[model samples]
Target: MKTEKPISEGIMDSLQMKTSFKDFNSLKNEADTLYLKFQRMGFIESELLELKKENDSSYLADFSLGKKFSFLKVFYSSEDFTKKELQQISSEVDETYFILSFESIPLSLKKLTAIRNQKGNAFARVKLTDFEKDENENLSATLFIDNGNVRTVDSIVVKGYEKFPRSFLKYYAGVRKGKIFNQKKLVAQNENLNGLGFVSAVKPPEALFRKDSTTVYFYLEKQNNNLFDGILGFANDEETQKLTFNGYLNLELNNNLNYGEQLLINYKADGKEQVNFRTKLTLPYLFSTPFGLSGELKIFKRDSTFITTEQQIRATYQIDPRSTVYVGYKGYESSNLLDEAIAGTPIDDFKSQFFIAGGSYIKPQNRKLFPVKNAILLDVGIGSRKKDGKSEGQLGVETTLNNIFNLNYRNSIFIQNQTSVLFSESYLVNELFRFGGINSIRGFNENSIDASLFSLINTEYRYQFNDGIYVHSIIDLGYFENETISIKQNLYSFGFGLGLNTKAGLFKFNVANGNAQDSDFSFSNTKIHISISSKF
Candidate 1:
């Protein structure tokens, strides 16, 4: 297999020569086959210069392998891009071939035909002609482009769900009329659409290319993304020494009118004293425009002590298929109902107004479940706070991230973190951030903790016996600081749970024990939670 001047390494290994031949003619034929293989591999000047019979069963093969030839020059024309753009691509190809020892001609030819492919030429071909080889083996050839036909998108037809939103075709699927036909992007159309959670792919998208226009077809069915969820908790009160019942309910509606709109209603009655309610509405792609509008309202009461209300309105724009940016105004008002000031600080009425900005990115996860979504959200506010008739500047920030790593078909690990902070000279009791329970740290009473700043990390390791049955272990850690009382503490909790997916809903149950600030775990302090979430 060794020749006079080898083109490069690994070329001999690439030749599929017969190790044992029946006769001398068979050996010659094998050697001849290698020449054609080398020629196809960019050694265009490879030839069998000589063959010598060493003995009855031994032979020496000699060959003249030419310098590896790549595209020293390529000439072509395209209707989509200008001549200068084409020259820039050609110049890039020229730089790719330095000494021309590697066979990369096909890859360069792929680059040559890429523009036409993106410009409605799916079957474009590059034919090299008038090849001229110099003494140094540098070859220059003309590349004649054979662009089959122009295919401009005429329309996108939704088959299964005929009433599916048409605007999503252009904004989400990247398909529209007069747009150039691209097979690669079209092949990925189902993935792009599924990311929005509006619909599931019945099959891959299809294309009907004709001389006049190209028609893109989408086979999809609407998904039941609208959800109703509830969580129930039972625990023993350390002070009261009695069993307590608490829980939360959530209702969300999405794409009801097929315009990608969403409405959420959530309410929580965690304890006898703590009550929370919230509502939000979002309208996307408003009036055939790229902008969206959203409004949110929330109210919280701490049993005859203090009540707080917040309202926000925002405008959103899609930065891409997976991301969105929003800017809005947030307003908060709080009043003392019963509780008095502590630590010599007066608990008075307070109000705040902030201009808020935020962005969100959602990444779909790989999981064998009804819903497989992961997301990240960041929101920050710069505003003014008014307390005791004095106004001061304040900053507020919130961040959340959720990620899932699938180990295999049956196991996974999930991690999520949430942090919220209100930065100011002082904070009122009613205005402080509150968090607890299933949505946050487990094995704790809902809304049982308050702080000016807090961050929580939730980790879960799950094992699935099947798509509908699974078990998981939960470990949560958190830290919070309350500046009003000059207190800071760390929190930790551990728990185990199992889940069952049914036609009515997906149910999960957990038993956990939580401890904070060096407190020892107690069996009486254990909390049990049961949750049911359904999408329809």
Candidate 2:
């Protein structure tokens, strides 16, 4: 007849396998295996003490204390333990061990060190050790949730602010109570809040269980107003034909207002002086209810070389919860960069000024085609242009489908098309930048095109570095047909190189190869650009 025994009795019996001989060597061997397993799971030598075997001819043992956390002991003893009995013993041991707790533990450490796996005597720890501590000893927490599922929180309890509502806290929550939650999704929404440049740090919700059901809570820290920033740099440019010194001032005013604003002004000089000024006022909560409003004005002057001014007003209203519908108006006038490139005949002779007013509906999607993170965008714009005896309106569509579907990597495909009037042009083909420098056909020259309905299919693959720098490889393909130059020269180019896009604007340096038709006519096209924009 078989007799039922307590779990401890079973464990103690297993330890007594060499009891008849009291084999210290066999006992030490088993202890050694257990020690190695613990060590692999991050328990160091200092955390272990003495391990001893019982003197009797029985399976029994004990370990001295020094473990990082408290533990419970279960003994297993069996004269002839079967496979099924060992499996049962393991299940019982695990179920018993997980309930043990240590007192006076930091919450961060507690949350990250949960046991993830146990194979016999071996185990695995799930989270990284460094994740538990912040620079100031503040606890770091992470909460993961499935995409597209809503969670309800009864009330938000904040500790730092005296003039905000629980709902206002929801804005800072970077998540909504009834909205679906996904880790990447929440981060994107919170990033918008961060872009407002008000909060110093924002953290996501922590999943907790009360009575066997799961819930989430968020924690955040806000920075005070009056922020100051500066930048200084030296650059040499082949396009500008000058080596220049650059500096700027970035100021944030009344950051804690519904209508937040920033001021940016910069100066640059090589053999001459240039000044650029830009400012924007944003209404984060325009009339409340997830609607936004912003206004921007910019001016640039460079002492008889060039001068330009632009004004814009944009507003976006959230639609379908996960996306927005936006409409904006912008007007700008600027001198042509190729004023001297047009056979040295000042290309700026064509005065250009236009007002663009258009509406677009955008949807945010997760998971992309290919492993790269991308966005899928569909934009349609209608506007009027009054320049060079061409007073006409334009209709256009721009697509960034990669950004919608791929949300975790750096690669994109962009297709932009514009349909116009006041001239008879191809409905589907007007302007196209097939290849060259950075955005499109990469093996060719920069802005090396004539005219038409141009369609550019450009792809860029970018690699990011640790010290705020990145490099990219680009491909550009473009074609244009001028009535004067009847023979259409379709250009293709491939380029690869690096660029520095810091707090400073783009200063790209690349080497490219281009082909106009079957001829291999290419040149080194480099660009040195700068902007003291307070925002990325």
Candidate 3:
């Protein structure tokens, strides 16, 4: 080779010739490798190599780089493929577009073979046959493709958790019997199943192939995701002039019966004598189908002012493994517990019924105090409310988003945004939405505020020391409209919290103080929250 040759830099780079070799066989093997490399680059297969030994430690070689070949025209040979099979390939991919590197026939052929393999032709073979060479140094040929036997999923076998719900297999894992068998896609199906909180994979996913079908195997084990959690808040009561207890308790059970169902019970109290309690049950994959049902019952008592009872039921359809959409009905009935009605106060009893629709998506993340994961929940309802036998139209909407962004492995930012709205001409204190406390807005008592419309957002910067412990700074901002009194205001809170994850459970503690934008902050407004979540 000479420095002043017609070969371009790319051609020279493509020739990975070594400077020296230990033996004649070593030198010959390198020459053989280069032959295949150049042939893959459309170089003539007839290129010649000449070798000469000059001394004990030196040798010289010359390569006759022949003219490169380009395609005159290419054709896909579907003569042996069934019409149905051809239609399947055409629907998924354009068989004609795979001949991209027309000059490099082998490379193009490799692409064509891979496309077939993905389309259930696991043993397809392709070759350029019936070649006709032209005087211009180009060749025309038919790309004869032999699409081997088509394969489909015959069944799925679970080694460890044989009782796994079949519906979870078809809907959640996206792997169903009789589906197209693509080894590449099947290999990734394990992650979709393992990402679930209710189960874990004990062994690597495996596949067994047969002459006519494919069977995937999963070694799974059930995981306990049930939790019993409690929150304790200490806030000074202005009327009592003493610190009072207010918080919430939650018990959630999941997949207990292996039906992929969930049960939750929650209760909250705000030392102001307002107590809220709710219980919900969700049964997914009804009759081994994508449909599910969820029901909820809620009771709220505003300390002798009013007691409200609400019931809701939703019919849900699993959209994918991680998402679901639901349509539901919500009914509310309220009665003033007060002995006498107070004038100018919207504290009377009322009944409201709503038709609701919503959807939700959840994705799990690393098991850490401040894991970088994502979730979203939202719903809207249009219905009516009756007060003193007077009926009126009402609309309600609610949405919440929780997400975490990781700046690095140990550092992250967690943000949550929530909005709730209830629109009606007339207002009732008992029917307005309530959001406060450590969960929604720190430094405020649970269920302390009543609003017709409100938007709240929280941003927390966190540093995880390890899997168990993390520290964070909390910042919250919100705007609310209290339609009862026609007053609107902005609220803000600044705080710091620490979270600990242990074998026993997870614990979080926070110290925060907040106030409305129109008011002055007070150290006496400080609130402390401590919570623990234990899972079984």
Candidate 4:
């Protein structure tokens, strides 16, 4: 009883031998003899076979493999067959493997008669059309992925913005809608909307799948959060033979008024008559609650020696966009006008009220500017101060560290360290830990060392020549201590600098020559230090 012709008559006899192949070179010699019969059935060696000659009534065989060995020999089965004996030897080698595996070769005989009527199916669903490859090549990838079902996230569009605030870009793009379509959370929400400095580009989310979800769009590019910055500087202080002129001005207002609030105003001047004024306000989510708030008012003067005033208020908590934690309240006042031939010397005059705590971690390699590759800052505090009415007890500690070391793509190697301490046995000359010139210890004189304790270290080796120009070579080391001027000091400096990273920030010029000693190093002193700054 050997009679069984019915899977729709074997798909109508494979569509009549797929329309009697009109000999295009005998259908490329029967597709190179069915590519050696699918490599003798174990199918491996493939060099992306080709045949093309598609005009004279068809013949365009271009078979390819290596999408994981062509889905394991086209959906597996070959240890001497038996996936129903490899579907009866793949339906007698699927008409010469659909005339050498298709380029629409008569629609691959209706996909080889639907894989021989889905024979002994363990898995089958092959749909490939014009695939592509060579993405920094490991070669084997002619697109083939078929483990289905799992999409979700149906809806999230958000193209270009005008004034930001689609609830602050869906609250910093922690993508929501229905979940599950996470490609590493959409590339970490496009790097948290390009680190939100009013976003200047964020693309890469375009999803769109659909038969039950996935719509994601997100393309953004917005910048210009209103800012104005200015600075002009000139210096020459060879052991205080002074000749300095510096000026700065800034005004900013980010996020329009959409509640991610920010506003700043600053002014500085110096030709040795130093003056500074500041005003700030930042809110970034205080009431919406991811906690953040800032307030500041500072006024500093430095002619006869000091005149500082400050009022700060801070609160911050963002534990993740690179860490932060803060707390603050500072109300200060210092007014020492030196000159009574330095009367009663510890540089006096003060008023205080402080309560501060700080934290910062920042792991930035590039996020706008600065030579940051890693940053850490810490602050400790305790306070209670009242000048003449006597109340005392104050303590403060500060620390900073930065390290960078990429030695390619324009070389780098920077290290910075700063340390401060004040245990107040009467701490005022503008809170005391001063360190000298051009951002500290640069061959002295600018706040020329008077300490409660201080330490500084800077080492640099930059070298970038384009895009925000750079050139550096610096080394500075300083240490100062004061047990009420029983004093101990050490300073060493070396330098070279030229930087200009702008959009309105980071401009520098430095020159330093060393020497400063005491603790009986015979009271040494050598000079040469120049400085300039502009950090918008």
Give each model's whole-structure lDDT: 0.79, 0.42, 0.79, 0.62
**Tens digit of per-residue lDDT, candidate 1, span 1-536:** 56765344465566756778888888888889888877767777889887887778888778788676644554444443465545544444332221222355566567767767877787888756776776776676666778888777788888998878876776666676787888777767566777666687788888887767788888989998888997768888888888866778899999988888899999887667787899999888877766889999999987768889999999998776677899999999988885555564446688999999999987654343624467899999999989878999999999999887878878888899999999998777787888888889998888789889999999999899998999999899999998878889999999899899999878889888888978987887789988888989
Worst 10 residues of 2 by lDDT: 115-124
| TM-score, per-candidate, Cα-based | 0.76, 0.46, 0.80, 0.28
* Model 2 Cα lDDT, one tens digit per residue, 222-310: 54545444565777765786876566555656455423433333232322445556777766545446667778887655545555666
lDDT of 4 by residue, 197-311 (tens): 6665555767777665668777887765566656768888656777766877777777776566888897767667676778999886565555778999988777777777889
Which candidate number has the best TM-score?
3
RMSD (CA, Å), candidate 2 to true, equals 15.3
RMSD of 3: 5.3
For candidate 3, lDDT tens digit of each residue in 103-149? 44555466657767777777889887776667876665666878878
* CA RMSD of each candidate after superposition: 6.1, 15.3, 5.3, 22.3
Model 1 has an lDDT value of 0.79
**RMSD (Cα, Å) of candidate 4?**
22.3
**Candidate 2, superposed: residue stretches over 4 Å from native:** 1-151, 157-174, 177-202, 207-217, 221-282, 296-312, 320-322, 328-373, 376-379, 383-452, 463-470, 480-489, 499-515, 523-536
